[model samples]
Target: MKNKYLTLLFGLLLAASSCNDWLNVDSKTILTDEDISQYPELLETQFLSSYDDLRGCIQAIGDGAFSYRQHHLSSFTDDAANNTPWDAGVMSINISPGRVFASIFSQSKGEILTPVWPYKEINKVNKFILQNKDSENSEVQSLVGEAYFIRAYMYFEMVKRYGGVPLYSGSLDHINSINDRATEEASWDYICNCLDSAIVLLPETQKVATEDRDRANRYTALALKSRAMLYAGTIAKYGKVINNGLQGVRADAARDYLIKAADAASQIIQENKYSLSSEFGDLFNGKDEDNNEIIFRFSNVAKTGRQVFHDYWNMPYRVKKAGYTAFMSPVLDIVEQFEKLDGTIQPLDYSAKFSDPADFFAGRDKRLDATIIYPGGEFMGERYSIYRETRVKTASGTKVYAYSNQEDWTNADKVPGHESYMMSGYDGIFPNTSGGGFTNYGFYLKKTLYAVKQLEDYLSAENEQDAVIIRYGEVILNYAEAAIELATSYGETKYLAEAQTAFDQLRDIHGGLPSKTMTIDVVRHERRIDLLYEGFRYWDLKRWRIGTEMHNKQFDALHPILNIDETQSPTAIYYTIERVSAPDYLITRTKWFQERDYYCPVPTDQSPGITQNDGWN
Candidate 1:
């Protein structure tokens, strides 16, 4: 998968002469400027080239890179959980390593710019559209809309990663050598307006072509707008309290944007085409392409398909894949956040006595069971055996059945192997038993593992699962969160009930249990569990801007850290005990040093003249 994308990036870099050179070498009648003018298909091909970047959209922004580390850094600034160097490892004190996140710091030059190929490709298509405006293909309008959406999306990613990024809406020429940086406000306005403009021209519905599934539609474009506006509104309004580094948007403007976002999302929901997946598990199981929850997805099919690199990042070490398993191991703090099955926050107060898995779910949210895998349960139609193996002795020595990895297990190096000496606290054991002691986090992911076979062939891009980007559930939560925050801020208690109503709709999808009072805290906690690994928690903390205190004090205080040796596979050695509470490290208040963490430092290398966002350097 990485190789394919590198090839695409290579093509984007050599796009000018590669095609012409290949055709010339073949002695074929190469389509020149005049030839392409006669054959309109040439223009269409040029326009279609933009889709390559879109097809790699998962790589472009969907990876856990942003959602987990970059965004979660905000949480570190906020008081959500502890921010260890191990989290992003290299960027511990905000001094990022050169090779790792070259673009993150100004040190590495242009290495960290948001994947530039897509923008360049989109620019090419937009230029093509403008140039061939006279061509009466009739299909060109939709293409223009798609181009708009793609460009808007590209810019949106750039804005999120780096607050005040250089905005390039049109084709860049050789003469346009100066690197321009737009104000954070201007960038947000441009992004939102661009998406709206794209939405204006797009079709309300299209013939569900396989190709078109990836292309921007009216709802998809609108969804992008909703997401952008929601972030913009929140940052602009909350930046003062959350992160002073942010240039907050006007509250009224933010509110207006939120309403627009809600309306756009409501249009998708009211239109009745998409809905919640009947089974929660089916959503990630890879068979539910028809699952209404997936409003917009980067569609991947067999062989040449999208490899969910994000999933690989946090996968459990017991389920091994790749040559290593460093990425995707769930942070210890995140593991404790899941509610019991009955809908109560997994108590972090360690003094509590309950240790049984089933008892853990008592009075907790049902969504917890839906999102995370508990100790012993049926996941993906297979019974998971989580009990620790015990050796029974009779006379001489005891015979024990311990979990052993097959010699060919790919993630062996990520473990405590004799050859590689790093202590990877994978599964249940901490690597480097004598030195580093224990790993900061304890849990691995079980959410998206299709099967053991799938784990073995992990690197194969054949995993065609459609990850849900925007779902009705999220929309409901978004509406509820915004309404609650706005209502609270505006001193109007009326919207609180509306927020509760939104919460009820989400609960109704699972099973209309009962009504619960809603608060920003309640909604935020619910979002953490509901959206567990769908990749939102870090960003949520960032926008709220309290990650540091959250990271430093919260989970460590709550969850008990047991010292386990790197003697064997975690799946085989330790008993999958019931959930337990941690100590008292959690900070109830949202107050913390959030401003510095709100926006990521623009990779110092991209624009050397621009100062690093305050407090980061």
Candidate 2:
């Protein structure tokens, strides 16, 4: 039996590698139904391998150099902006309607920006389910349940991206013969049903010795169901069903889906297995490994070296020695979303001059301090001197010495007084033409960056911080959102009390802010603030039917100017905030998100009967 299992696994893996088309299965290499019936244990090896395939979607990392080394999903959203000019394709396709359709389907650019269809992973999962659905071994049955969860997750990834996609059930032999797209309603239903199966068979908590903790449990399936159902609910309420329900759900079904989302979340909450982490910052910096806040995450055990490259790519230039540093610059638009400690939201007045630019961010939400590196902020035992220009009180009436690049700062003779002042901060808002290693937007991303004391530890792909895929914080927010939508949209007021408790707990525990009355806008603000840069903003905007509205203009950036006057004390030099274009470049293009951009075009080169999504053809 063991030798047979090994042979089947090798043949399946070999066949998977040789086949380019995910749908087409080579009959000679794969396991036959008769072979599976004799050796039911063979499904276990295949089941375990599915987790490896699922990691790509969970980590949000791709095989391409651009995705693995540079681009992040937050950069494609208004939450952050990409500073690297070479990787502008990430932003350009997202912003422009004219280029988006073709760019996503292009073989060269598409793989870098968008996630590839997970039909290959789904195929493996289907085969596992078909053979092991009635296995006599209890463990094999549990593995079959996990297969359902994996299939649901892959379909959710597809449904969210391309609306309705081809849903494959049974083995590869069955899949290869059929080519038809499921309705959007049917796709969402299929995902929810798969989760239902998983919830029934999966254990509440994974056994530490036998099963890996990172693998799916009952609550993990429930958590995903909560998220997926909420997405379907919003699409039904806000989107129009088109092409015979291939793209959207019926409006009347919105309430039922919202209820399912809320119930799934409530079940997890009632179980009381997880809680918010004590320190919000520790969640991402590899400090809170055993914390209850994480429901599901891609674990990065240190010696294995299977870790994320967040610190190497996203850390400010002053901190890291190698790689393209400060790749994502948190724009002012997202920075202002963090409310004050007193629960009053205030926008920064760009027109007003300040004695200190950092003062503009004073007394804001604590999450802001944890999530972004503002000008004059201290990080890794070093202060960020992110100024665009130095204003000196010269004999020639207040000389403004602007630096075009980092090299310009070293020359003292260039300044009027030769005062030996550092022109640009190691962290910067340099001109777009100046080159990489500086932020075009004033702020730097601090969410996923790990603080390394040794400079050598900042090597590419060395940071071992675990990438969080799903956490308790997101589930709490999902519950609050679904309940609030139900109450506000469908007049379902019974869920208000439970929703309010979940909503207030997040803000009070994680954010250290007093809770306000629940509203749709209020829930959304809390969600964005808590989950910033964890890669939820773009999808949230899409599901809410507000992508076109939120991303149709150029984002703003701050330019800090130092007041280096003789009258000012050397230690007490103040800075002023100057509103600048985010890129601050000539021939700047306004980011425009069209309604058609809500669904990415399905590539025409795929299966025969698959109809193209609306506006793509």
Candidate 3:
């Protein structure tokens, strides 16, 4: 039976890439164990074929090839807004028949971002682990461990969305049965157990230059376990459960999961492998200047690397450098979360604080500058001046009255009489176009964007930035969060202080901000901003049961409008950050989530008899 299924697994893997580039190079040979052993390199090829399926880091930004491709997960949250109908169904939580499965299909037609059956990868990984568990080869054991890690990672992806998925640990000639849903408890247990097995089998790290460092090691499994357990704990404690036992974790086990989360994090923390750093911004910029900070990065290096079309989608609408549209825009709700330089949580009092709109940037978190591109902000050493050079004809030989109210509109171009700009900003009216300059909200993104010298043509052409899956900053924060939860449950102050120290490390480095008064909420807020676009917000909100409160409510697009019509402002030209109407493309409709909305609707086309999540039925 094992031999028959091994042959099927090999054939399925080869055939899975039938439509892809994998078949173009490899020989179409029916492999027996004998044939594979004779050509040892074929085994390596088989192993590598596993990663090719990932293509790159998971991006639901609609590019595809990432798992489950729920672009709406990020878009629907308050943190981001997409200016296209592609994700409207996602944002509104209103899944119509036409767009019911549109989330996965939104990618290029027939482009499979996630595997048709994740079981295919699971089967391949299972066979590899079975073959390797007894092998004395340390190198081969590491490969085996990675296989375990890969399986765990893949299963967690499904478990996160589908709640619980069918379990498959061994070879199969065919999956003839329904392979019914395991309880959410069983699913998380399976995932964590897989990681534990992986940790025991793998080394601390593999330092050889020839080997890919991106492969899973001891810390990789633990980091994922920590994160996964944290999710389970949050969901069990804060979310709702159903009669089917498919959607929610048991509340009784919630604290235990949280404790396990802290323990998993503590293992990594005690190892002293990595930590937060001053050059934290460099980690996101693709330079990898501070390598120690990243625990396990999704490599997008040379031939093996995955290229993300970031600038193609996220480039500022105003910039004519790239032809791609500004796909996703940041929301005012998230922008306001960045704390003041003094570490105080003061909402940007648009009327009072921004008498001059550009003063909005003053004394803000340094991370705000690192992450967002605001008006009057400079990039690549050049200030973004949207003002054009064209002149208006006048009686005095084109006495060029600056068409912009930017200089004279509010007397913003100076500190009253100084040459420097007091409100170094625009008149708030840039021509809105489909191609680039129109912003749904007033802000632009900078964290995902890495500026290169004019010497390189690749910045606009291709993308290969390292997708940091786990970093030390997150580890510290995770530990901080878990510790805070533990403290809350047990009435301990040490854990609170510990979380405070962890947060203050980041706050101090980014801006010499004050120490945090550690609570789970404060720890989570730090995570929201610190791990901004790395795709954590949606689940975080969902798990906290706040999605219905924060996300289901009507949100505003803050327009920093030039209101010369009003005497309400002392300065006739002072900007008003009005809570203006959301753009038509922005899905501003309030979300309506029933108790069942707590879980994602399973894509029914994948299989028959697969139970629908809570409310979907």
Candidate 4:
């Protein structure tokens, strides 16, 4: 097996180094200098490969699966649906190093961990550009432009993950000099400049083939730049917390960049080439192509499956075909944030299990049902219930991990409590081993998973549900957000005009919703519901400096979870009830006080010599 693996890897290297009479390259091949003369095709292929880099890093950093192994630190923060560890549950999250700070730091480290890979890729393409400078192929310039765009994209992510990182533009070699990390401000400026240069060189949408949707185009590059700048600008503009008891960035500078960011994003949205997906659910379906709305995404196919995300979120408690038992549960905080279908904040009592779907959940935003499975919700086109047969392991060596597949109506009294079924049936708690792996109680994610096996191919990595990097809707939202910030910075009412234009664009794409007045609160809310679970919530909250608004509270809820011991044995675990109703634990006002923690302290492990952000102690 080892020999076979080596042979396959060697073949990949050779294919990368040399073109054959067939003019075909293996998918696994790494690019090399020799492939430079091939021009646009080879460079384009390398450009697409950068996306694979994105996929690997993001799933590891952002996706919620395998607990700490796959970072879901945002879940620990208020952005997610907290389900378990009832006693100190949500409050415990405040200091849970593994889930919150550690995960954030790990994501930051991911930026630095494999810098060599992207650096090598950039070098391969750079070689092509250097060798073929005189070539008449107009495609050459575009391809070169794309290569720069790819490098900028990676660096942008790195800077966001870590405040600043080492910048590399040219090919590195044995004799090449290594550079130290740049200051955060300098790194961001360089990234923006690189993107600007690439934009000038890149082809407009008309130049690329349909099959090459994954490659960066001018619009995509601009969209990316808009996003990057928006993030940087917000942090700099609204920055309040002091580092070493010093202010971070001037508000004026922040506003300047924000206006630029808004302008860039507006350019894309104004292009009119992209729009929102017709149905919110369509965005997650793998079978969908790059509709007008999608600016950037992955092309997963059967041969190249990417089902890991769905597998982590669906339930083994219900799906007979699902080999894995555990489902990535939603944190309660996320659930609370969902507005009712009527566009009003859902009443707290409306979350009750027996609440009528028509009255409690009715008139709610369609997105709520589209994303989460609430009590008495329809899943796979059928009425679904969490009360089903379950097995439990007891300490006395009795494993009673079996229960009736019906709602426990026998406990008529408990039904009204709403606590018994809070978890949607599984052992409603975290570290709960209900279905299989470690799970947080409460509801599991079901939207991304397939119901019938027919949709299975599309649900996995093998399916081609493009992992959207940018789109028209996102651009619209950016305009709205940046407009608000710019408005605030300039003390101008026209900011409202900018914000209103963005809102109308989004609603028009969605067949036009009722018009409403503009406010920063409204714009922020729209951005949240518009782009949930795409891993934007955490960062979105951070940029707004609202992390403390979320983190300063404890979330405790009752739910069922599995109990497992060493050796992965299922022992009898008792089903206990818990809830957190304490006002101090549930309310978060700390963000109102110091604000700087919103940026998150850089991981202590990265450099102890560098002080953790002020007030961390």
Which candidate gets the maximum lDDT versus the true structure? 2
**Rank by lDDT, descending?**
2, 3, 4, 1
Native-vs-model 4 lDDT? 0.51
Candidate 2 lDDT at 334 equals: 82
Q: Model 4 clash tally?
A: 52
The parts of candidate 2 lying over 4 Å away from their true place are 1-43, 58-69, 87-92, 98-116, 174-178, 209-213, 301-307, 349-357, 394-396, 409-420, 452-461, 568-572, 584-589
TM-score, structure 4 vs. true: 0.71
Tens digits of lDDT, candidate 1, 82-101: 22223233333332221212
TM-score of each: 0.71, 0.89, 0.80, 0.71
Q: Give one digit per residue, the lDDT tens place, for model 4 in 1-617.
A: 54554454455457654222211222232544455453335445445454555454343224222122323444544544322223232224344332233222132333232122234444544454555445566777777677667667766655564555456554344313323546566667777887887788877773646744567788888888888888889878666424432225455568767877887887776676666776665666443555777776655554344434443434434453343343345544565566653445653452343323223345555666666665446666654443322233334552333233223322222322122432234322223322343234344554444443444433344433445556677787888888877776577555567558668656544423445555678778777766765667767776777666764455543232222222234322222222333122221212121354454344443233544444455
For model 1, how many clashes?
A: 47
Best by TM-score: 2
Model 2 alpha-carbon miss at residue 490, Å: 1.7
Task: Tell how far residue 349 is off in model 4, in angstroms.
Answer: 4.1
Q: Please give, for residues 391-433, the per-residue lDDT of candidate 3 as tens digits.
A: 2222344322222332243344433222333332341233233
Off by over 4 Å in 3: 1-42, 55-63, 67-73, 84-115, 209-213, 301-305, 318-320, 352-357, 385-435, 454-462, 490-498, 561-577, 588-594
- Each prediction's Cα lDDT score? 0.49, 0.73, 0.60, 0.51
Displacement of residue 146 (Cα, Å) in model 4 is 1.7
Which of 1 and 2 is the better model by TM-score?
A: 2
